[model samples]
Target: MRLWLESAVAGTPSWCLYNAVLSVLRATSALIISLLGVSMHGACVSAAGGRLNSRQRFLGSIVVAWALVPVPGRPQDLSRVEQLYEEAQSARTRGDFATAERLYIEVIRRAPELANAYHNLGIVYFMQRKYEGAAEVLEQAIRLDSKLGPAHAMLGLAYYELYRPEKAAKELQAALRLNPSDTNVLIYLGKAELQERDYKAAAKTFEKVAALKPRDPEILYDLSLAYMKLMLESIGRLGEAAPGSHQFWLLLAQDAEARGDEEAAIRNYQQALRVKPDVIGAHYGLGSAYAKIGKYDDAAQEFKKELQISPDDWLALWKLGELALRTDPDQARQYLARAVSLDPDFPQAVLAYGRALARAGKTEKAMEQFQRVVTLAPEEDSVHYHLAHAFRRLGREEEARKELTRFEELAKKKDERTQQMARRLIEMTRAAQPLADEPEPGFSPSRDPTHH
Candidate 1:
């Protein structure tokens, strides 16, 4: 029975190592029942009794079907082993670890080469938190059937529980190669990589998980942690490589901007420009910081300086154009035209250019740009709003009304999306509340590996 079951399962088209464990179990059960009689055990058949059942009872069907597959050379001994294996599975499911352990050991004694028996025993040990025993049996399962992805995944998890991150990562990676879509294995691999201080690898692994589950707050949080760790690691390396350099100050300025410290960002940007007068982003960063603080004149001057340094800077052109819209329509048109010419696909720039055209009393030309904006951003409420205003200016009242209605619908959906995002953030905060009492970990630049 053991040999027959193994051959039936292991022979499944290309061995199907990438299949989920449940699918393999189901297929093996179905094939065994189809090829051999269903009533190998009268009790199992009577219990099944052609009635609908829960998943637990459905899983029990494997036991009934497995006992019927003929074994070579030792039919009597193998039938006893099969019965014991089924009993072990039942005990494991019932949470009777002691009985399950004894039955599995007896099954192993009769069928020493049954890799799935070892795998099941490993699962039982794992369920009991006996990581050492689980690891031992899982290793044996892998030795017997090297392509057993579930065993590899379980062994990796066991190794992780044992605090052997290097081994865990290796086995988890092996499992992922066999079953690339296994998010659980990917998660464990990412954690193991993080524990090994391989921030880059951890970030890459977590990014894959995030792609697979974009809306999962937990995965997204872990991905953010990985990216934060990777950033800190790079910052530590950068400090060691070029302390007090313009690039270092530039990085600090950008970090300050992201943290909403406009004053600090301005100071750092100035320092960076002082260090390297022609640095690519220093003028632009300073201009943005000034604009954030409502210093329009200073922002314009800084943006002009950036244009002088990099003549085709589309962002600088767009910012300059936007600033001029309320003051000088002619200057705004020139800047916006150049900005649009440089980056035609930039929806924000295009939208701003349309506004500039509208302010210049070129309603027809403005409508053309609005059409382009609509094509570029059909779902954008602002796009529809501007289009509706243009329609009103053209005296197309019905079209204007339709556009306004579409704008309101889109705006409501946008608000709902924003509310949903806020709810997700709140949920994430609640999930993290238990750790609020924990002391926050500090990063020490001096402890960086790159530091002397």
Candidate 2:
């Protein structure tokens, strides 16, 4: 029975376990033969046979002789942990933010020390517009990996969104310290400084960004705005009695107009133009501002002056078209057509041309212009709504309804102006009525309203 058990153990598939059992049997037999005072050569032969049959017998004999054997430690199972982390990363890449967040939470629960999971989860929260939740998760990430620059940067962004500018500044500064060349961090720091009204610091930050990205128009525009703001603030500190004060005020006006501060900005621009009639930007700025304030006649005169200086100024032509639209649709069409001829991709010119056609009751032609706008920028809900109205006027009820539905869906993601236009379009299309009950005193409808 003992021999049978030994043979069975030796023949097992697990060679290491089989060898272990053989080593035990051989050691016991060798000890028994030594105590019996029999010739040990036969016992040594039996042990040699066991060693020849077993893989680990030689190593086990050496270990037993030295009394120095290593005990195997427990194998770690990381399969579940690995699977959760992988799922979290995959979900985030696909923009499935909710699922990504849940998976990240699971990973954190299973492996509390996984800093990357917390960081990624925070990013998902940020993408979902959950600023407070993002802040919390990112804060935890920072605790786990205090030196992680990305976590600091993200925490800064979250704090900025939460109206915690002071904390945002600290985190952003830390991120910058870790990666001084990060343009995005620099831009955020500048924005945070601007929020804190630290214009000087903001200017310095933006200057660094501008240095890194010299030809970026947006950065230049922002830098220009900051300079203009500083100039205005400087002038505001001085009373009118300050020497050369007119020049200061004119400079302030030019800067304000450049930044789109229409009314006061226009006054300053006009002042600058009056003081130096050859100032081109001042003339353009004054004309554009006049058009914005609905002073069309004044705008037309200013634009004419601008054209005298720069005959091919497309902006002047577009502004003239916008001014003409309120009074003369035909003339507006002419100016807008000129602007389009100069720059076919001009969105403002396209919009104005569509408005001109609509106002003139040329609904079909109006629709062509609006359709062009949608083709040029499908994201523009106003263009869709305008096209819908044109379709309704042209008696294409189904197309009009389709465009109106599309406009509403797009409008839900729109700003105030576009939303208002979409709502007006919806009301008009649903009521199936004209905007006006009677034609204006001298103007006549180009087509019968009842026909549509």
Candidate 3:
């Protein structure tokens, strides 16, 4: 019986030997049974008998089913799909986005239900700046595998890039539900909120992200921007109460300037400066503000102070040069030249330098500067017009005619009022002669009549 039990436990094919041992044991039954009952060995036999009976019945049924069940008799072939997926992953890991995209597409074609292939394909589209394509691909991935949290998160990013903040919010919210602790998802949701112009929502989302990633400077910067927006909105509402209040005055000045009320803007800017002398923005603002009012000396003074604080401030230099143009051409040229030297790439500076040189009778150099302006800003009609004028001054009639034709083409596309002004200017330029022949009006004849 002991041999039979051992054979059963071991699953050995020794049933004949086990049965012989059992028969021997049963022949000495009186002595063995007396010993088994006297010892704890009988309990072990009872437990083993119960366990073995159940196991033997279960094994017998499985064997019977195995005999009846049909087998394909061949190994399943998934090698093609497996190979393509491996190649896709390898290409993705190697940063060969084009190859990765192709491989992922092939995988999807072979197995359309592959959620991973869709997800990776979305990532490849995002790398290529195809945000709309990424959003579509990621949506398919989400449909195939609802539990794919990262796919939903990437879909949110794609939607945000495509300026579909509403869709982005939904996808990102879903991602957060799937993985509440994902810090990157939290940050993305915050950015989506910002794009939606829901400043309070953005602030709240960012605060949660900041709690998780305390030292992240980009998160802090975004938080600051949201707060700043809220503050500016509040300030805007408050500005309506006290018209002459310093903050209110500044707001009014900015609003007036934006609306093209130059005189009103200048007055408010002056008032704001009187209330607060050390406002850097006000000082810079006042310079342009005074220039609008034709207060060149005052404009020059304010711009000089701005330059003292910020020596390389190009806008201030430009404004000062423009102010000097009306009253002092030599002074204007000096400032404009200084501005060009400070920022070689400033298109406005180049245009202004060309104009100043033209006014100062440096026709050759002025033509070169105007040509440079046209090269830098070919689409700018003003630059083209200026170039035409410079060419006309230099006796380059064909070049001048070509530029004027280009200017007319551009002007025709403009509004009625601008086109009218351009037409008047073109007529004036055509009528005008060289500087040497056109002396300043109201100059007195020499006091010695003999010389005249």
Off by over 4 Å in 1: 1-80, 106-114, 177-183, 203-215, 222-224, 326-330, 416-452
Considering lDDT, which of the candidate structures 1 and 3 is the better prediction for this target?
1
- The runs of at least 3 residues in candidate 3 whose Cα sits more than 4 Å from the true structure, single-residue gaps closed, are 1-172, 175-197, 200-256, 259-279, 293-298, 305-312, 427-452
Better of 1 and 2 by lDDT: 1
Q: Give the per-residue lDDT of model 3 (tens digit) for 318-384.
A: 7778677776889889888988898776667777777788888898898788777667666556666
Local distance difference test scores for all models:
0.74, 0.70, 0.71
Q: RMSD for all candidates, in order, please.
A: 17.5, 17.3, 19.7
For candidate 1, the per-residue lDDT at 375 reads 84
- Backbone clashes in candidate 2 total 0
Instruction: Give the Å error, residue 293, model 2.
Output: 2.9
**Candidate 1: worst 10 consecutive residues by lDDT?**
434-443
